[model samples]
Target: MIGSLGLKLARFAVVLSVFALWEVLSRTGMVNPRLLPSASDTIAMLGQLLQRASVRSDLAVTASEVAVAFVLAVPCGALIGFAIAENRYFAEVAKPLLFFAFSIPKSIFLPMFILVFGVGFSQKVGFAFFSTIFIVIMSTTVAVDSVKTEYLTVARSYGATTAQTAFRVYLPSMLPVLLETVRISMIFNLTGVLLAEMYASRDGIGHQIATWGENFQMEQLLAGVLMIAIIAMTFNELVRWVETRCSHWRT
Candidate 1:
């Protein structure tokens, strides 16, 4: 209890120090106030932006893009991961290919996505899926592959079929890692969607931020950025809470 309190206090101090330093820098002209608005100005703008229905609508659009990307990625990733994990020959052949593909910056595909999808929400979803799907697939494969041989052997000794062993043994063992994968995937999903929006989109929070930036509306831009950070952090915290709840049942 004491340690947790101390940690929380330390985090608070760090945040406070950062804001204080930011304000001082802005006031002292060490940093360009036009580009890096003080914390107070940013917070005020954030408050005003939050009250706007249009901002809420943009927020919803970004959220939907992330949701769609996650839904598309998870099952496909799990299937691919399962296939690679279950077969040693396939794993040896496909793992390197997948890793190489992941190494390729997914943003490079954004232009093609925009060309194909035409600067719409579909392009954003596609970009996000392209960016995040590989991580999910790789994490899922690693998690399933790491399951103990003894556990599978025991299941087999009890006459468990492949499907039974996979669902009853492997799935349970991989749950924690799967949840972690989900958390990570959401973060990337948000980032990718935002990048897509910023790159070339007519709507969404990222577009708003881009518009604000182009106009030199530093407070508005920072507010949009902060809102995104808040949304991502909120999602991460929720996933972490779920993880904590399932911790006892994971292994």
Candidate 2:
């Protein structure tokens, strides 16, 4: 508990130090206010942005794209992961192909997505789904392979069927890894959605940020960034808490 508290305090201190430096830089004109707004101004503008209906709509657009992409990726990723993990020869062939594809940055395909889907939410969801699915598949396959053979043997001795053994033994053991993959994919999913919006979109959080930047609305731009940070931090904590809860049965 004390260690956790100390870590929290350290994180808080770092954030405060950064904001303090930002405030000083803006106030002293060391940083151009036109390009980098004061921390206070950004905070104030963030509150205003939250209160605006148009901004709320943009947030909703981004949120919906993320939700659709995440929903599509999870089951598909798990299926792919299980398939590869269950077959060594197939895994040897497919794993390299999957990794090779994953190594290519999602940006490389943004133009293709835009060309295929045009500048709208479909492209955003598609981009996010493709970008995030690989993480889930890679993590799940590794986790499945790492499951203890002893656990499966014990289940078999107890008369557990193959399905029961997998669900009751293997999956429980791999839960932490699966949740960690979700946490990681959540971040990348958002990045893909935002990149889509920034590249071309009629509306969304990313489009709003880009609009602010183009307009030289530095304070609003920073505020938009802060909003993204808040969203990411919220989901990160939520996933981490669930991961911690699931881990309690492990050790």
Candidate 3:
């Protein structure tokens, strides 16, 4: 426990040092304040931005897109992944293709999404789903594979039906790993929504950040980025906490 706490503190110190350096550079004119605002100033601007209804709307739009995408992606990915993994032949044939697709940059398909969905909310949500589903599928496959063969054999010896074995043996074993995938899926979903909004849409936090950059509003741009970082970190920690709780049996 002490070692873990110490490691966390060390990470916090590194982040604090980076912020301090940024502040000093901006305040001392080592870096132009107009281009690289102090961390405090950027945080202040974030507070101001939050007070604006438009900024709040943009945040909500992005959040909703990410939520929708996550909802669509997780179950579909899990089912498909489980199906593939359950069949040895199919797994061998498809794993390579899936890995190749995962390696390709999803950004290149943004133009196609824009063309089909017209830079609307649907486009953002669809793109986010597309971006997140592959990772979730990959993770789910691994989670399924992690289940012990002994568990399955025991279930069969007990005369368990297929559905019973799935629920009694596979699910309990996979839950911990699947929970970990939730964190990864959220990250990919959030990134996909932000990228879609930045590339084409007009009414998301990503779009607003892009606008600020185009207008050379460095404070607002940095503030927007900070807001995203905070939000992402919060979700990541929340998912991590849940993962830890669910996986306590492992310990």
lDDT of 3: 0.94
Model 3 Cα lDDT, one tens digit per residue, 1-251: 56998999999999999999999999999999999999999999999999999999999999889988999999999999998999999999999999999999999999999888897999999999999999999999999999999999999999999899989889989999998899989999999999998898879999999999999999999999999999999999998998888789997
Off by over 4 Å in 1: 28-30, 161-163, 248-251
Candidate 1 lDDT tens digits, 1-251: 56998999999999899989999998888999987999889989999999999998998898898889889988788888888888899999999999999999888888999889898888998889888989998998989977899999999999999899879988888888888999999888888999999999888999999999999899899888888878889989999998878767655
Give candidate 3 misplaced runs (Cα > 4 Å).
none
> Candidate 2, residues 122-162: lDDT per residue as tens digits?
99999999888998899889889879899888998999998
User: In order, what lDDT does every prediction score?
Assistant: 0.89, 0.92, 0.94
TM-score of 1: 0.93
**What residue pairs clash in candidate 1, if any at all?**
none
Model 3 is weakest, by summed lDDT over 10 consecutive residues, at 242-251
lDDT at 157, model 2? 94
Model 1: lDDT of residue 141:
93
Per-residue lDDT, model 1, residue 20, is 98
- Please state the error at residue 76 of candidate 3 in Å: 0.8
